[model samples]
Every structure is written in C-alpha cells, then in structure tokens.
Target chain A: MKNKLLFSLITFTTLFIMSCKQDLNDLSNETNNASNVKLVGLGIMEISYDMKTIRDYETDFSILSELDLSSVNPSEEKQHVEMVLLESGQLNLTITELNFDKKINIPHEILPDDSPKIMKTEIIGNTANFYDINGKLLGSENIPIPNHRETVDKIKEIGNKFSAEDINKTIATMQGYQFIDNLEEFIRNAPANGVQVLEQGENYVSLRMSFNKIDPRIQGASVLLIDKSINKMVGTRIYDAQDNLVQSVFFGYNKGDVQSLSAIRIEQQTHLPSGSEVKMISISQIENLKFNLNIK
Target chain B: MKNTIFKLVSFFVLFLFAQNILAQRNVAWVHGLDGDAGSWQHYNAIFDAERNINSLRTSYNTDNGITHASNQVKNSMDTFYGSNANNPLNLGIGHSMGGLMIRDVDRLTPSTNKRFGGYVTVTSPNYGAPIANSLMDGSVQNAAANACNKLNDGPLSEIFSLPYGITANLTTNVLCNKFISNDLVQDMIGTPITNYDLRVGSPTIEALKNHTNNSNIPRISIWAQESSPVHWRMFSSSEFNNDQTLVNYVNDAREIYNVFFMLNTSLAMACGVGGFWFPPCWAASALYTYRATQWYKGRSWIDDSENIWNSLIKTTRSEQQTYWAYIWIPCSYPPSLVEEKNPNPNCGQWEWREFTRWVSVNYPSDGLLPKYTQELQNIPTGNRYYVPGANHLEVRNMSNSTLNGQPNDVTKARFNEIFNRPQGDWFRTN
Candidate 1:
C-alpha cells in the first residue's frame, strides 16, 4: 500500500511540474509575437487603511455623582447605583424609577419622565464609585464599559448587511476590469526605452519592459514570471538589481481580447513585503510594447 | 594553517559587512483614501536608488473600511518579516489616510515585531478634511452630477460614464460612510462639523483625543504651502486634480469641495462665536476671513513626551500677495491693483499659473490638504519640513530632483534624511 501511494505521489509531482513548464512556455510564446498594440485603459488599484480604536457603547458609564451616603452601617452590606461609561457620548442620564439596591443594571428603554440630564462624562482615567445612603464603600464602575445593547444591535445590523460574497464578487469582476478605448495614445506617450523583446514563436512573443520605477529595497532578479493558465492574470515575480529572485506577488486580473484588433488585456501585480498586493487589469487595443507596425 | 584560517574568517566577515552596506532598508508606502497601489506611481524613483519600496494598497470596498485595512497591514508585516517577535527595520511613508494606517498598524499590532524606523506623513490630514462634510452633506454629490452632465455634453461622454463610478460613490453616500465612521477619519472632522459633534458627542474622536501614544518612535511631517495665491477653483485643474488622464480614474473631489469653516472650533474661538447654534453667519464669515488672511496655526505632532515641532514653512498672506503682484502685475501698477472683489484677484483664476501657486498664505496647502489643518493645539511636535510651492502629490517625488518644471531637491533631501536614519534617532533636537 505504501509503495503504491509513493508511486502515485511521484507521478503526480512529475505531471504537475510538466504542466506548469508547458504553461509558462506557451505564455512566453504568446507574448514574444511581434504584435503591434496601443496602450489604452489601465486600472491600478491601491488598497490601504488607517487603524483607530473602535469604541463600544455598552460598557460606558453614566456619571451619577454626589451620593447621599448618610444612613447605612459600615458592617452591613448595602447596594448602590454604579454606572460605567462604555462609550463617550451624550448619554441620556436615566435613574431607575424605584432605586432598588443589589446592583442596578442599566436599562435599555429610557423613560420619557426620566428627565434626561447632561454631563460631559469621560471613560478614560476616571471611574464611578457608588456608596450607600450611609458612607460605605461600594463597587466602582470604570470607563470604557462593553458596548451597549443598542450599539451591539447596530453593529449586528451592519454586519448582516455586509456580504463577503458580494464584496468578493465585486472585487473579482474589477480584478480583470479593462478600458481598451485609448490604447494607441497611452503607448505612444509611454516612457522611451521601456520595452525589450526577449523571445518569440510562430504564434506568440514575450518581452521584458519597465512598467514603472519602484524603490530599491528589492534587488537581484532575472525575468518576470507571468502565469496565465487561468482566465485572469494572477502572479508576477521581480528580481533585484543583481538579477536574483527576491519578491513574488500574487494578484488577479482580466484579459483583453487579444485575437481581435479591438483590445488587449494584461495583468500586472505589484507586491509589497508588508503583505499588501495590487492586481491590475490593463486592457488596451493591439498588444505589448508599441513596436513600429501597420495599423489596419 | 592558523594564519590561513584567520584570513578566511576575516574574508567572510568583510563579505557580510559589504552585503549589509549594499542592502537597503524596506519602505512601505501607504496610499491615500480611495487609493490603490498605483497611487504611489510618481514617487517610485525616490527610493529606487537604495531602498526597497512597497506600495500598500487599501481596499475600496467601503464595508471593510479602516478596521479591515489595519488587519491587512499587520498581516503584510508578519508575512514580509516572517511570523516572529523580531520585526525587520523599516520606514513607513503614508500620504493622507496612509499616515493614519500607520497609526492603525501601531494600534492593532502593538505587540507585533515589525519595527518602524521612522514615519513620514506628506500632506496628511491627521485631522479630518472639512470637505468630508460637503461629501456627507450631499453638496459634493450634487456638484459631481452637475460636472458629469457638463462633461457629457463635450467629449467626456465618449470616454467616461455620466456620473462616473467615483461620482456615483459620492452620490450613493457609501464611500463617505466608510470614512466618517472610521476613528482616524473622525480625527479630521473639523470646520463644518459642530463643536458639539467634534467634542461632546463624538465617541471615537473623543477617545482618540484622550488616547496616548506610549511608544517613542519618531514621526516627521512634510507639508507644502502655495508660494502664490491659489484660487479654490484652481484645484479642479487637470494638473492638480486628475493627473492629466483622459478619464476620471481617481476620486479628486476632496480637492475642489467647498470646506465651510463656520463650525471650525479654532476659528470659532478666534472669532468668539459661541453656542450650539445662532453664532451669526456674518460674524462667522468675518472670523473666517480674519483666520484666512492672518497666519493661522498649522499642523503639529505631539508625542507622549510633550515635545512639539511647529510648521517650518511660514509666509504671511501679505508676503504672498506681494510676490504674486511682482511677477504678474506691471511695474507701474499698485500691488493691490486687483482687490479681493475681482474674480481674478492675485491671478488665481488662471489654471496655467495656478500650479505655480497651488499653496499660498491665505490658503496654505499642497493643493489637497490644508497647512493649517496640520497645526492642531496641544499636540507635541516631532519634526516638520515646510516647502512652499510644492504640490500635494509631488511631495514624495525625491528622485529626478527637478521634474514637472519644479525643483524638489530640498523636500526630497529632507525626505531622504528621515528615511535614512535609524529607529528612534530621527528628528532629535537634543
């Protein structure tokens, strides 16, 4: 049984390796062809965000200061109103209609006769301490209490409305999105000495070109590995100044109709070591670097 | 044998040393809002010489917002440096929301090993942009609809869809929600947003205000001011607004959106306008005029140490007016020949000359973020480099020194200096 499994694994590895090489060779051939194309629509997406502390309202404190603390005994256990500010806001200060004392849990339904008082309450660095009618130390409520029920409900509503599948679908369609209307002009105005054809075959051609200048943290690389076995362009590799492999980027893109004179699609991925990646779908008319050719 | 062994070991040591010298530090470029990795396309050459620069792309899907983006950045750092407690030394350069992303990185992954040598914010609206109000209040959406209709009448219909995708984003009120909800975005809610909203009721902004940065990492801010008088309308020009593209590929609404400073806390304080409402519109406008004409406070970075660095670029409105008059006005005419009443006062109406004066004394900004917004009260200053006449996007272009017919060597060198320094050593005065 072991021998059979080993044999099967070896065979699978060999087949997988062969298929990858065949795909790369085919792509090399396809790009190497001396195809005249114009640079038209290019879509480069930049994804970034800033992190800030998200405040939850549930555990917030409503300051009810100046407790009476005039009657209870020091030894006897007594209850008092302890408020915590879960989130800083204009909290409608409400006290229980009947001030019962084991421990007052903040109610969600605020009554109209509650007489909403106002105070600039803070959740940081300060806490609320409750005492009995007689001066006895009760528990203290700290700032930044867990989010309120209403706040949690709102978050849930937002979460329910948010569909990862919808988002992913939108992003996938945009990944290979193209604008091939003005390919010729973009290529004509591209930086000079930007393209160098490397290899070619009967039906294909491959070329190396400088898309844009990126900073020097990366050095040493030889060629761009373009994997096009799938419908969209996915990953690309960059070498350092010394022609040694250093970075690899995995992304997504849409291909333009290369057969027709109408448009061309190219997928380029730029990788940041910070794990951020950009998959660009550049669709244009014709193809590759604009070489001198007849326009039909 | 002993001598040979010593020589071999010495050779190995020397080789490693040489490799270290040649290897450059890693640079992560966090782009602005609605920006993908391509946003940093212009500044590529700046670090190509010695540093490896990675452009971090943020998600456009508003649902994820900054919270999700922060997680992505942390994951990227972990992946880049390997999952270990030891993080490689790197410099983080963020523009606009990108800077806030860095702050978010620090917030989310406080324990992560990725050590930032230094952080540089170029024209970052650490405080929220007032234009976000116009966007949220439906003014910008209305304008975009108007602009799209106008553009469609011309050749714009052939290339761009009427009410472009970005315009629709603004109109739908989705993209603005992603921003207004973010805590970092909340930090920048100035001007139009009432003081009650900014101070008493805003939980996120209030939390941010009280939150302290315990780390000792150095932060350097590079801001630009218009050398000449720049009209607000000039921001709509192709050079500053659209990157000279045939189609509107990026959202440049923040540039031209009218920012009403009536509710600005500082301006209110300056004008002595009080209360939740009924501050007297004329009084508020007079205060705004005074604030705009006078040398108002600019951006400052205050760390836990209580250290502060004021804006280095300072040119009074009077000085800027004089310079504009000297260049555009005839030698015989008075400098104030064109008063504020004239639409073309200070020659600001002309888009061709507007680029030269993208920032000015009255409106100190890099044609995107205002200079005054950088100068919040009570924040400790770290390091500041001020460059007048520098556009917002071009602030990161270090290489080529001179491009777009402008000399950027001074600002470029300043950027290089901050990046080249070791962690905790940059922007030190003592």
Candidate 2:
C-alpha cells in the first residue's frame, strides 16, 4: 500500500512540474511575440494613485491624478472632486438654497481657460466648516448642515435627477476607509460644529477640530482635499477625533532629479486610536480633466 | 623555483586586476563650469554602481580665471585619483560647461585607467549655448535673465512670467529691456558652452580625432523635460533640463506644480503674505522644500543642492526602500524653448534630434567617448540605440506614475521593468 501511494505522489509531482514549466514557457513566448513592436508610447505610461494625505475641505487639493489614484489604491468608491474658483467680480462661492437655478452664470476658472470647470458641492453637516473665496474659515456653524448624507444615498438622489455618477475612488479618496471605529464624537468637537474658509487661492485656510473619542472606523482627518483651481475634490481623509495623528500622507513631487519622481510621506503615531484609514474622493475623476494650458 | 613562484603571483594579481576592470563598469562624473561637486548628486543617485568618483567642483568664484578653472580641475583629478589608490577607473560624464572641462581632462590625463568606460553629456552645448554669446558677463543669474528676456521679445520684468505673454509683449514693440542690463551683463560672462566645440571639437571634427579609435566609450544624454521651471522660478535653463540629456527626466508636477503656491496654500496664506510661515517667500520656501523632499531628500546617498548650505547638517546612509526605482521622462517642448522673441535664432531648441546632431558632430572630439565605445564595441553593436519612446527623465529618476501616481504618460511597473533591468559595460572586449 505504501509503495502504491508513493508511485501516485511521484506522478502528481511530475505533472505539477511540467505544468509550471509550460506556464513559464508560455509567458516567455508572449513576451517574445510583443518584443518586435514598440513597447513604449510617445510619453511615460501613467500609473494610477490614491490620496497621500487627509485634505481640508476649504483648500483645493491635487495630490494624485486618475491613473495615479488607481495605481496606488484601486477602489470604485474613492474618487476626486473637480472644482474651480468662479470669478464673481473677485473669487466667490456662496452656499445658497438654489436661489437662482435658471442659469445663475457662476463663472470660475480652474485652468487657464477653464477646462476641468468648477463643480459645486453643498454637503454640509449641521454646524460643519465653511470656506470663503480664499478658502479661509468663515465661521463655525451650529445650524442646519445641508445635503450631508452617505455617498450611496447622495448618488441615488442626484442620479435620478441629474445623471449623478458614483464617486467611488479618486485622488481625493486615495486615503479611504471602508470601516472604522469611534465615529460619533468626531463631529461634536468642531469649534462651531463646523468651520468655513474663504476662496481657493491666495487666501485659502484649513481648520482642524478634535473630538475626545472616535470610532476607529473614522480614519484620517475630516478634511477634504479640494481642487481649488479646478474647484473639485480628489479625496476625503478622516482622522480620529481624539488622536492628533495616527498617520498622515501628503502629495509628493520631485525636485528635478532622476532619482525619485513621486513619493508620499507616511507619519506614524505613537498613541492610541490605532488603524486609521483614509478615502480618496474623485481621484478617478482627475482623468476626465483636460488642461487649457493655452499652449500650441 | 622562487623566481617562478614570484612571477606566478605577479601574473595572478595582474589577472585579478584585469578581471576587476572587465567585471564592472566604472562611471566617473565631472562637473560643469562654475558648478559645485554637489551637482553630481543626481548622477550619483542614478548610477549607484560601485566606482570611484572624482568631483571637480568649483564655486561661483570659480569664474575667477582660466587658472582657477584649471586648478580646480587638477585638484579634482588629484582628489579622485587620491581616493582610489586601488582599482582601475573607467567612464566619464559631464554636465553643461563641465562637458568642456572633462574634455580638457581627457587631453591632459593619458593614464591607462583614464581610458574610461563611457562618456555622457547632460544638456551640454557641444558648440555653444546661445545665451553664452552675450553671457560674457560672469553672473549665471544675469545670463539667465537676459536669455529669458530675449525669449520674451523684450527684457522680461521678472524671471518668472508666463512664457507666451512674456515673449509676445517683448516682440510687438513694447517692454524691450534689451539694453537695460546689457552693460552689467557685459562683464558677467564666462566660458561659452560651445567654446570648446569651436576650439577643440572643431579640430577633432576636422580630423576625426578620437585617439585609439576605441569605440568602447559611448555617450548617453539624459534630458530633463519641461515642467521644471514652473516651481523653480529663477533657476537657470541647463539646470531646468537634465543638464541636456545625460540622464533624462522631467519635473515632477506633484511637487513642482505652481498651483500649490498660486492657488492652494497661496490662498491659505494670502493675508499672512509677509509672515515667516505664511510669508510669500516662506511659501516659496515651502514649495522648494517640498520639491527637495520629493526627489532628493531621502531617496539617494548624495545631496541634490535643495537647500542653501547650512554648515550644520546631518547625513544618514541608511537605505530607503524606493518603490519606483527609475522613470523615463516624457519628451515635451517647453514654450520657452521656442519663443519667437529669441534674439539668437541660431540657438537650437532643446530637441532630441538637435541634440543627436550635436553629439554626432562632437563624436570625434569628446575625450570621454572612447571609454564607453571601447567597453561596448566588442558587444557586436546590437545595442547603441535609445529606448524607443522612452521619456528622457524616467531613465534618470524613478517614475512618478509608480511613485504614488503624480502624473504620467507611462505606468510605474513598466517604468520599473525598464528601470530595474540590468545594464553594464561587462561585455568581453579584445
């Protein structure tokens, strides 16, 4: 009986080895088949990415592109928001209750000729932070937060009315959390239940409110990385209400060397509120953006 | 019997030394005129292979005279040769005017080891950079400003204006400051980039003059692409590009994107325009710091002059696990390169084809080319072609696409596949 079992095992091993060899051969053959053609394109191939840091709502955030967002963190829900600072005389974005829905003519210029265009978002929690034209804190709010809801519900409401697409993943949500702990307390710590800031350039401000306790589910910071030039968001990072920093990441760029091109800074925390996560918003959307550099 | 033994040992040692020469490629970097040895930082990062380095760095004061430049070169040679008491040296590289300096070294030093393994020029003007014509004035900033102004159709008000407008306003009968700083610029010029080309390269081209006909010395140009100046407002032109293609790369938008200073943090600090943290200069500093951190901060062993020299500094040689090792920069024409207002029509735009023409013209003249040609000549010539469609910057720096997705015309994995592939000058040569 032992001999028979040994014989069977040997046969199985031989088959396995043969299969592995065949797989490698196939892979090599495929590589060879494509070797004759140009393996590269006119430019460097773009890789996707995710949010590197928690973004503040008021400030315009542009950490990663769509390809970069997808390369770093692949998720459907995480995405970036495109925004622009409308030039109403000067820079201005007022959060009103649809006072003039009939072509209000809000003019914004994100790129040189306004390519990506500004997107308007009015999802404020009760007493949430608000920003002015320059992205500074207007005043903490304790009043009614308008249009704040879960992403899914928000998608459904806008979908039936105005072809709203689900913003699952983007540069904004490069740092996203599917689940976390200690959630309820985070909202309560804001100086006025929320803060607001001015426009997006030459005057934008960011604010941080804390909570005594938070659900680990609430990862990263409450700040949203906004695309002020484009007037959109790339991601939303949620931090623990109590702990100052579990870990934070920011967008990276190179200083004209051939060594490293892009890098994210990950700062570790020594304290509690462990396992914080971040979600990029509209990171997937950055791809749709075409710049109006006004160059030939 | 004792004599035989001694001879045998000597032969063995010689054999080992010869093996060392063939076993690994030796790459030495020479600096540009009036450049710091520190500028080799990027090269050090790109070619991490084990080899002795001879840093021929001089300061802004290096422009003092030919004697100073020559002394600096001699001192550099002494320092490099002194450092490596053992092992044979091969390969040589230079950036900008440093290219001319290396040629001088090749002419002066005929040591067997100095035969060199290869040669590379980054954004060097084999003939002469157009700006050098009027750059007789000794200041780099002034030359740069004059160049920008000429490109802008008039003397530019600031070095940091948009290229098109700057040039347009200058050309159509307005804002011409051509003569404003022309006199100050008169005494400010130094070695013309192509002066050696005229003095040396012309003779070599005339005679097809590469000594030894050693094809082992190959020339590689790494070109840094267009986006560099967006963040680095007043930095010079050659520097903005990859010193003219010795190690190709582009500016990383993630860090250098002016939006951070113009819109994002710019707005955040509008009211605090002059304070240290929020001051405009501080914001610029922040952008600069961000740029430094993006490429050189923790990535390489060398310091890529990102900060003003602080006498007190810390050095760490610990390894950093870089996810994306190499990225080829995409080729793009910078608007500034082809301004209609450019005064020197002869100054060629930074084009790959133009660069190739310059290389071909200087092929016989470059001293460092023989080393590379000799190293590769015996390999039967299947190589010697540029990676197709590869961005110039990607080969020198790790790809941004994979470096957490800054932006790209290519992917990180692909860049890595090309990047991490092994390359060396180890082919057997007769």
User: Among these predicted structures, which one has the highest DockQ?
Assistant: 2
| Segments in model 2 whose C-alpha atoms lie over 4 Å from true places | A1-296, B1-26, B42-75, B82-89, B108-117, B134-216, B227-430
Per-residue CA lDDT of model 2 for B74-129, tens digit only, reads 45555655544223434456554454444444544555545444455443444333
Please give the CA lDDT of all the candidate structures: 0.31, 0.26
Q: Please state the error at residue A5 of candidate 1 in Å.
A: 99
Q: Per-prediction DockQ scores? A: 0.01, 0.01
Task: Give candidate 1's whole-model lDDT.
Answer: 0.31
lDDT of 1 by residue, B352-398 (tens): 12111111112355544567544333334647767544445545443
Worst 10 residues of 1 chain A by lDDT: A64-73
User: Taking the tens digit of each residue's C-alpha lDDT, what string does model 1 give over A35-70?
Assistant: 111112110111111101100111101221001010
Q: Output the TM-score of candidate 1.
A: 0.33
Error of 1 at A72 (Å): 68
Candidate 1 chain B has its poorest 10 consecutive residues by lDDT at: B300-309
Q: Which prediction has the highest lDDT against the true structure?
A: 1
